[model samples]
Target: MAGVGTVRSIISDSLGRSVMAEQPPKIVILTAPGEGLPDGLEALSGEAELLVAENGAQLRAALPGAQVLCVTDFRTNAISEAWSAADSLQWIHATSAGVDALLTAEVRESSIPVTNARGIFDRCIAEYVLGQIIAFCKDFAENQRLQQRHEWHHRETEPVTGRTVLVVGAGSIGRQIAQICGAMGMAVDGIGRGARPGDNDFGAIYAQADLISVLSDYDFVVIAAPLTPDTEGLFGAAEFQAMASSARLINIGRGPIVRTADLVSALQDGEIDGAALDVFEQEPLPAQHPLWDLPNVAISAHMAGDFIGWKRALSEQFITNYRRWAAGDALNNLVDKTHGFVPSTTNR
Candidate 1:
């Protein structure tokens, strides 16, 4: 098949030993026009036949013989509708950490393995979380609000050095977040799908089911868990009510995990003091959404994990995996598709 060819290459250098030629594999780079493959990715030229697909028509046309699908435009769902044409697809790589959008019914029915850009965003996102924590503790939002009025209103700010933080995810990003928080002298506890003792940077680990009992213990409620059946709408009225009224919420995970309406009401009713939401249940949050009007809320356009050259990093990660795939080795950052996140390394 055109997309399933074996890679063939010659080895010549220091030792100068000759080997049989290897054929290149076929790879389809599925992305929007401007979001094409990153620079330096062309280095694969000698080892693979690369196809670029910019639309449903283009993707469907390329799928028949393409062995690897690289979803560079993570927002598109053309792959699901075009799956039937991907007769030779052996693996899929999503540039985004979240693969839920790419794993459609057709994809779920197929056996092709899926990989993602996982580690690339961990440090950046953890740093973003720390910034949010500091901003909230320092009352930066209120300071800005007061400044807009040209009035000097001085106030005392709470110190975060010994405050408690509850990170509701134990994946790589969560661990990084814990380490930073712990280093700054904050008490950090992590909650995971299957929680256990003695996890790094965490004072303790709590199971998902224990969120209610644990909600009141932390000054910051940080959601960094993946979107899954068990975690969807994980924080609702009951959970919010259990939290201390002075506690602030930070969500860097999928938006649906915190019920929007419930969160709004919680904030409105002073169930929680404030919130810093990076991701929302809806993208490009509607113009009239109540969250925007709230005084204590700080919102971002979902760029917490985005750092300069992130696209290139994603490309490099995929290329590293490509080498593994071509050599028949186990892939890295293998998402637990059945669970919607990477299982802890210990679990793996």
Candidate 2:
């Protein structure tokens, strides 16, 4: 994987020095149809021949001599469908943190190295989780509603300090969330692929198997896990029922992680107090979706990790990694193809 982006062909110059062959490495930037290219991509213009592909046909055409593929449109499967045409493809990079959509069977089993924008989102998402927690604990939503109605009603709100927080997926993002929540005087524990104790960030790290057993104990439960096969639809009616009625949920993870219908039922039945959801099973959740009208649920498009100029940030990250690739250095944020994420231990 290290040499994938290195100039493969070499020749001797007049001075008897080794020089790269005349054929320059071609890099393909895969974007969604009609979407503008990522900012700062011009940084690579002098290093490699850059081509943009917005669909399968374009990707297939661009992959023949392409050594590197930068997938700005992480959600599309065009790459999987056009993989056979990747005759010279050595490395693939996804600008988005989640690579579930890109990890097709062929891509996962192949030796071609896969990387993701993992660290880029961790802190931004951590801040989002913290903001949502504060909003929920302080009942800011209710205050907004009361203000909208032009009524003055004084009420007591819950305090975040000293409350328990259970963060599922104790990876980099989860650890950052723990760091911030802990700073706010909250007791932070985590659930990950396996259980461990005395972790630097979490008080106790429990395995996924223990999630239900520990559900009722925490005042706040955050779904920060990746959307692997094991996590899709992980939280359903029973899981919701296991939660304390006073507890709130924050889902900045993939939408399918929680069953929408079951979640709605739980909220209506007081199975859980409230939820702050950024991602949903459906993008641009239907205008008539009940989740939108639910008083206890706060919803947003999947923008928790997207701040202003984030596209430029993502492009800059790729440029930094591209330099590493050219130098035969181990790329950062290398995804464990089998696991669909950069293992927490490996990337950090």
Candidate 3:
């Protein structure tokens, strides 16, 4: 439990000034037991009252004096109640990058500072994307299916060596994907909210306006951007139509980025070669959804970045940030409630 103790100590040290003012706050975990608390935080169970409340009532009961609330895949109703019941709440940290699920009307309306595990999964997810691309290009899935049927079929395997990849986000995750693709000898282009000059990692970086114009140029398009107002439905019919006939798309960012119906149409029409989607516009992807039957589409249960050590990594990140907070240093990856990320003014 030394890890937990260390986390508590770091948090205490970070809040030393506030604690000295007779305002020490409790930390609450408002996620299901199945979701698992971040490692190192369990040590705080003794030093600090650790409450794992999965429902609104339990959350409300535990929120009276809580300062920091860590939430995973639990519902937003509990989050709303916790925020409403705890007037002393100072910060909230989501275990996932996309906070949209936790953005209940009440929580969003509150002034509490919220942060997410933004950069932690960048490398892991980029690797997953790369692996999927390689698997699809090498026809691994097709080969396995053919083998299972006891049929030996020889087919030409495509190489991703000279393919062009259009990364639709220049953030940490997108940048990581671009770097990996570049290392594989693939030409990489990036699109983000702003266009920065001389971003060597990418062959070119363009603003949102240029997405359509350049969509047809890339052999593969990967979406790793945040789910924001501007990015909702960013890839629709027109965007898919603009892609090359042999192009494929991969979305590891947020669901709803590509309209599912339009994507189905594109796949059915052979407008694009294939797609690999880890996230869906709807969770659990509904059992009867037609997407499940698409031969060219691979559907994952939104689990690209979930590695075995995710909890430990999340704990380490929290600990580092807690130490910085204790030292009165500026926090890393602070979320700008208004514009999401404060729009990295200096374009990359």
Given candidate 2, what's the lDDT at residue 210?
Answer: 92
Q: Write the per-residue lDDT of candidate 2 for residues 206-261, one digit (tens) a residue.
A: 99999999999999999999899989999999999999999999999899999999
Model 3: pairs clashing at backbone N, Cα or C within 3 Å: 14-326
lDDT of 1 by residue, 174-268 (tens): 88899999999999998987679876578888899888998999999999988778988999999999999999999998898999999999999
Q: What's the C-alpha lDDT at position 21 in model 2?
A: 70
The best candidate in terms of TM-score: 2
Which regions in candidate 1 have their CA more than 4 angstroms from the true location? Answer: 1-23
Candidate 3 minimal-lDDT segment of 10 residues: 1-10
TM-score of each: 0.90, 0.94, 0.87
Ranking of models by TM-score: 2, 1, 3
RMSD of each: 5.5, 3.3, 5.6
Candidate 2 colliding pairs: none
Model 3, span 1-348: residue lDDT tens? 132112232224564553322323377777764655657776545445566777788878888767677777623556765556886676777777777756666667778777778877888899999998998899887987899999989889989899899999887788889999899999998998877779868888899888999999988999998887788999999999999999999999898888999999999999999999999888879999998988888889988998988878877776666555545566666676654542453445
> What C-alpha lDDT does candidate 2 achieve relative to the native structure?
0.89
Model 3 TM-score, 2 decimals: 0.87
Which scores higher on lDDT, 2 or 3? 2
